[model samples]
Target: MLNLVLFGPPGAGKGTQSQKLIDKYQLVHISTGDLFRAHIKNQTDLGKQVSQLIADGELVPDSITIAMLEEEVDRNKTAKGFIFDGFPRTVPQAEELDRFLESKGAKVNGVIALDVNQEELTRRIAERHKLNGRPDDDAEKLKKRIGEYFDKTIHVLPYYEAQGKLAKVNGIGEIEIIFNSLCEVIDSF
Candidate 1:
């Protein structure tokens, strides 16, 4: 099994590269953001809780997020592996994931951190806003989100790096080029 985690700031192309990786590796793509949005759209009990948190611009509690992931993993264990996107945003969550996978005798094979310049990230996010019409895509929210990512999630990199599972890839090129770079890294692993 080739469980993997793709980590990056918003607009750093994590989603795009995850799609490529999923297609190439036949791995299940578990995107927490997508999961949350789906739950919210369906108005599940958990979704109601998360929706309120999101409305208040607060992070969904890790327990809630992990519960959602646990359900997905339980259902998808038959898959070859998984590509975790936009998840494990904290050290505690990472640790929980480690334990969960350990119980299944599976561990993350790699963590790919997509590195990109902040200016370029902002520009790309602005373009995405125009294209996707997401209400939260404004400059102020984007900057705040980026700042929060660095503040809360940046430390998780070293945790994976110490385990010899973190690979940093430049995220500023053509889509194919960036995807190729990620593929090369994964292939090495």
Candidate 2:
């Protein structure tokens, strides 16, 4: 299986690129944020807990997140591969993912990070706010989210890098252009 981790800050086009990659690779897109939203919308027990935490601008606990992810992996028994979009925000979570995947006789193929500057991300957030009315794009929330990425989440990159499975694609300019670059890296992987 060609399991992948699509890494990026918010508004760095992770969602956009993930769609393209899924179409091209026929991979299951396992986006934790999406899963949370779906669960919350459906009012599942897990979703209720996640929604409360998210409403407080807090992260879901790693144990809960990993259990949800494990269920997802188990559900997709015949998947070509999986593109993990937003889980494993910490090194420990990454370690957990590794162990979980190993149990399934699969492993991460690579991590593809969309590298974008803060200025560009700010600009994109503005556009997204206007286009989608995303309340989480407020300045304070953006700062916290971006700060979290740099302070904590970005550290996950090196864990993958040490494994020689991390690749970066410039996250500026046209969507297709960025996607083409990502395709190059993924194909090589």
Candidate 3:
């Protein structure tokens, strides 16, 4: 299976590009953000917990996140592959994901890291907030989420790099241009 991880900070266009990748590659798109949002919207027990943590801009505990992800993966047993987005935000999470995938006799084929500067990320997020108005898109929450990414999540890149499964794609361009760059990387895989 051609499992892939699309890594980037919030508002780095991971969501946008993931859709295109899903269309072209026919991969199951597992986005933790979307998962959390669904739970929150449904007001499940897990959703209630996630809602508060997200309102506070804290990362969900690995156990909860992992369990949720595994369930999604299990539900899509016949998928050709998976495009993981907004997940494995820490080295431990990445390690756990490796273990989980290994048990299923699959492996992450590669990681694509979108390289977008902080300023651009902030600007794009601001625009997105205007359009979507997601609670987490508020300026204060966005700041914390972005900080959390750079402070801790970005370290996961090195973990993948060490495995020679990391590719960097410039994320400062038109949507199609950036999408083409990402496709080139995934195609190489």
lDDT of each: 0.89, 0.90, 0.95
- The lDDT ranking, best first, is 3, 2, 1
**Top candidate, metric TM-score:** 3
**Model 1 RMSD in angstroms:** 1.2
How do the residues 61-131 of candidate 2 rate in per-residue lDDT, one tens digit apiece? 99999999999999999999999988789999999999999998989999999999999999999888889
Q: After superposition, how far is residue 9 of candidate 1 from its true place, in Å?
A: 0.3
CA deviation > 4 Å runs, candidate 3: none
Model 2 residue 175 CA deviation (Å) reads 0.8
- Residues 1-189, candidate 3: write the lDDT tens digits: 999999999999999999999999999999999999999999998899899999888999999999999999999999999999998999999999999999999999999999999999999999999999999999999999999999999999999999999999999999999999998999899
Which parts of model 1 are misplaced by more than 4 Å?
none
As a whole number from 0 to 100, the lDDT of residue 52 in candidate 3 is 93
Instruction: Report the number of clashing residue pairs per model.
Output: 0, 0, 0
Whole-model alpha-carbon lDDT for candidate 1: 0.89
Q: In candidate 1, what are the lDDT values of residues 1-189, reduced to their tens digit?
A: 999999999889988888888899999999988888789889999888888666444568999999999899999968999999988889999999999999999999999999998999999999999999765567777777788788998889999999999999999999999999999999988
Q: Worst 10-residue stretch by lDDT in candidate 2?
A: 50-59
For each candidate in turn, the TM-score is 0.96, 0.95, 0.99
- Residue-level lDDT for 27 in candidate 3: 96
Give the C-alpha miss distance for residue 173 in model 2, angstroms: 1.0
lDDT of 3 at 144: 99
- Model 1: lowest-lDDT 10 consecutive positions: 51-60
